[model samples]
Target: MFADGLFILFTVFAVVGAAGLVLFKHPMNGAMSFVVTLIALAGLYALLNAKLIFAIQLIVYAGAIMSLIIFIIMFLNIQEEDLPAEEGRFKYLIGGVIVVAPVGMLLTKAVNSLPGSEATIAGAGFGGVKEVGVKLFTEWLLPFEIVSILLLVSLVGAVVLAGKRGTNK
Candidate 1:
């Protein structure tokens, strides 16, 4: 019962954070909201007994990634005048909701169709760092390496673009 209550609380936090992320006009506010969502997701991972994922979520996403995002936002120093007028934003939001409503209903139906069972604790060593590391290094090595390379390339590209912008100024 306690776990279920915590889950509900975390879920609500995540949803509210996500909404704030989308609804907030300022980039800094949106980024802060995303951090809240990330932390809530980490809590959900903890509830699921995914210790490795939970730690990674907090350390990598909520900590490192959010810091980087906030730093970039600060570096950009966006002003109100820099923002584009959003006269049609409400129309876009309503259209987006209309498009997504059917997909949300489908997801709800699919989840309801699943067989209900009592929650079971995972066996010992489940979600352990060693276990995950072994699997990630062995079975998922290629994809992992590919992702690392992609991230590196993107980082380099961002640096180059930022340098260009600085030079132009």
Candidate 2:
């Protein structure tokens, strides 16, 4: 019962964080909300017994991504007045359709399905850090390296973008 209650609370926090992410006027506040949402998502993943995913969620998302976002925001020196004006109401209408249409279709299809999804275990194998290491390196190596490279590129790009203009050209 206690676990269930906490899970519900975490879910609420995550949803509120997501909404706040959209509604907040300040970029720094929005970034913090994104971190909150990521942490709550980690809790949700842990609740599903996917501890590896939970750790990855916290480390990769809340730690690395949020830090990068905050760094970029500060480097760019985003002020309240520098923020762009909100688009017209039709923009929201278009955004709503873009977001809701696919989600509505997916939900409708999932509900109409006769059999719900089920998890199937893979062939017997070692469980834990060693197993994950082998699996990631053996099968998912390319994507893993790609993500690392992507982060490095993002850091370099941020530095370049934030560098002061040349005066004696």
Q: In model 2, what lDDT does residue 46 have?
A: 70
Candidate 2 per-residue C-alpha lDDT over 55-155 given as tens digits, one digit per residue, 9 for 90 to 100: 88888889987898899899999987899877564578578879999999999998888686665564444335667888989999999999999989998
The sequence of per-residue lDDT tens digits that candidate 1 reaches over residues 8-62 is: 9999999999999988888899999999999999999998889999999999999
lDDT for 72 (candidate 1):
84
Best by TM-score: 1
Q: What Cα-based lDDT does every candidate model obtain? A: 0.93, 0.84
Question: Runs in model 2 with CA error above 4 Å?
Answer: 87-102, 111-114, 117-127, 142-169
* Number of backbone clashes in candidate 2: 0
The deviation in Å at residue 79 for candidate 2 is 1.9
